[model samples]
Target: MSENRKKNSALKVILIIILVVGLAVAWIGYRAFIASSIATSEEYFYVHTDEPYESVIKRIEDEGIVKNPSYFNYVARAMDLQTGIKPGRYKLSKDLSNRRFIGNLRGGYQEAVPFRFQNLRLKENFAGALGKNFEADSTTFLNLLNNEALAEKYGFNKDNFFLMFIPNTYEIYWNTKPEEIIDRFSKEYAKFWNADRKAKAAALNMTPEEVSVLASIVKGEALHVDEMPEIAGLYINRLKRGMLLQADPTVIFANNDFTIRRVLNRHLTIDNPYNTYRYKGLPPGPIMMPSIASIDAVLNYNQHEYIYMCAKDDFSGYHNFAKTVAEHQVNARKFQQALDARNIKK
Candidate 1:
C-alpha cells in the first residue's frame, strides 16, 4: 500500500508539471498575439476605390506600420475584412488593434481634408490649387468648371461659374466629387447673397455679378483694403456720368499681359471688351477672383465726386482722385514722372 501511494504521488507531480508548462505556453502565445495584433506605428492608411484585399495588405506592408504583416493578414482574413472593404483615408495609431483597424476600414470613417484658397488669378490656377488640396486633378476640375451644361444647371454659365466659389477655408472629404464641390460653392454663394447684401447691391444699382466684376477691378488697382472703397467710389462716379472707365488695370487685363508695369496708349487700344478705356461699363467677367473685402467695398462705396484716379506717385499703392481732367492730368504727370524715374516703361 505504501508503494502504491508513492506511485500516485509521482503521477500527481507529473500532472502538475504538464499543467504549468501548458499555462506558460499559453501565456507566451497570448503575448505574441497581442504584440503583433496592434499597429506598431502611428500613420495613416489610404484605401482607394476598387482596391482588392491583396492591394490593401501590400500597402500596409509598404507603410511598415503593422508589427507583423503576416499575422495582420491572418487576422484580417479571420475577421472577413475582405468582404467589407471601404474606400477612404484612415488614420492609424500604435494603440489600434488589428480588429479595430479592420473595423475602421469597414465602417468608412475618413478624415476631412482642409481646403483654403484666396487671391487666385485665373480659373486654371484655381483648379490647380483645388486639385492640390483634394484627390481630383486639375484637368478634371477645369473640365467641370468649363462644362456649360453643368454650369447652367447650377444657375451660372462657364464664363461666370467661377463667381460661385467664395474665398474661404472649407472642410471637405478628400474623395469628394467635383460636382459636389461646385454644389457646395453654389450653396455658399446663395447664403452669402442674403437680404442685407441683396439690398446693398440694389442700392448700388448693380447685380451681384456686376459688383464682383467691379470688385475685381478694384482689387487689381488698390493693394490696400482701405483704398478699395475710394477706388470703387471713383469707378461708380464714372459709371454714373456715362464716362469711359479708362482703368489701367482693365487695359492690362485686355492685353492679357500682367507683366505690364505701365499701361500705355498702345495697351488701351486692345479691342477686348474688358478694355474699359475702349469699351465703357464693367467687364464681361472678373479679371481675377475678387476678395470678400473688395466686394463689400463696392457694396459700401464711399460717396465722392471723384471720377478719375491715378496711382499715387509715392508708390504707396494709394491712388489720387480728381473730379476734373486738369487735376487728373496733374496727378497723372506726377505718377508718370515717378514711373520714368523708376525706369518702368512698358
Candidate 2:
C-alpha cells in the first residue's frame, strides 16, 4: 500500500509540470499571435476605395506596420475581415493589437480629412484639387461640373459652376464622392446668401452672380485689401454712368493670356465679350474666383466720385484715382513714363 501511494504521488508531480508548461506556452502564443501585431511608425493608414484585401495587406507590409504579415493574415482570416473590408483613412498608433486594428477597420471608424482651397483660377484646377483630397478622379469631377443637368440642379451652368465652391476649409471623409462635394457646396452657397446679403445685393441693383462677377474684376485690379472698396466704388460709378469699364484685367482675360503685363490698344480690341473696353456691362461670368473680402468690397463699396484709376508709377501695387480726365491723364503720364523707363513693351 505504501509503494502504491508513492507511485501516485510521482504521477501527480508530472501532471502539475505538464499543466504549468501548457499555460506558459499558451501565454507566449497569445502574446506573439494576438497582441502587439502592429508595429507602425505612422499615425494613420489610408485604405482607398475598391482596394482588395491583398492590396491592403501589401500596403500595410509596405508601410512596415505589421511585424509578421503571415500571422496578421491568419488573424485577419480568423476575424473574417476580408469579407467586411471598409475603405477610409484609419488612425494608427504604436502597440496596436491585431484584434483592435481589424476591429477599427471593420467598424468603419475613420478620420475626416480637412480640405481647403483659395485663389484657384479655373474649374480644372478646382477639380484637380478636389480629386487630390477625395476618391473622385479629376476627369470625373470635371465631367460632373460641366454636366448641364447637374449644374442646373445646383442653380449654375458650366460657365459659373465654380462659383458654388467658396474658398474655405471643409471637414470631409477622404472617400467622399464628387456629387457629395457638390451638394455640400451648394448648401454653403445658399447659406452665404442670407437676407442681409440679399438686401445688400438688391440695394446695389445687382444679382449675387453679378456681384461675384464685379468682385472678380475688383480682385484682379487690387493688390491691397484697403484699396478694394475704392476700386469697387470706381467700377460702380462707371457702371452707373453707363461708361465703359475699360478694366485692363478684363482685356487680359478676354485674350486668355495672363502673361500680358501691358494692356496695349491691340489687347483692348479683343472681340470677346469679357473685354470691358468693348463690352457695356459686367462679363457673362467671373474671370477668376474672387475672395470674400473682394466680394464684400463690391457690396459695401466706398461712396466716391473717382471714375478713373492708374497704377502707381512706383509700382506699389496701389492705384491713383481721379475724378476728372485731366487728373487721370496726369496719373497716366506718370505711369507711362515709368513703363517706358523700364522698357516694358508688352
Q: Which one is best on lDDT?
A: 2
Give candidate 1 misplaced runs (Cα > 4 Å): 1-44, 65-67, 92-97
lDDT of 2: 0.87
lDDT of each: 0.85, 0.87
114: Cα error in model 2, Å: 0.8
TM-scores for all candidates? 0.87, 0.89
For candidate 1, lDDT tens digit of each residue in 1-346?
9999999999999999999999998865554445535554555677877788788889788878787777677767877889988887777776676767777888888778778898887899999987887777999999998898988998777777778788988888877887798888889899988999989999988989889889999989989999999999999998999999888887887888989998888888779988998798988888889899999999999998999889899999888999899999999999999999999988
Question: Clashes in each model (backbone N, CA, C under 3 Å)?
Answer: 0, 0
Q: Candidate 2: where are CA atoms >4 Å away?
A: 1-43
Task: Indicate the worst ten consecutive residues by lDDT in candidate 1.
Answer: 31-40
Model 2 over residues 167-277: C-alpha lDDT tens digits? 888899888877887898899889988888889999999988889889999999999999999999999999999999999988888898989888899898779989999
What's the true lDDT of residue 230 in model 1?
96
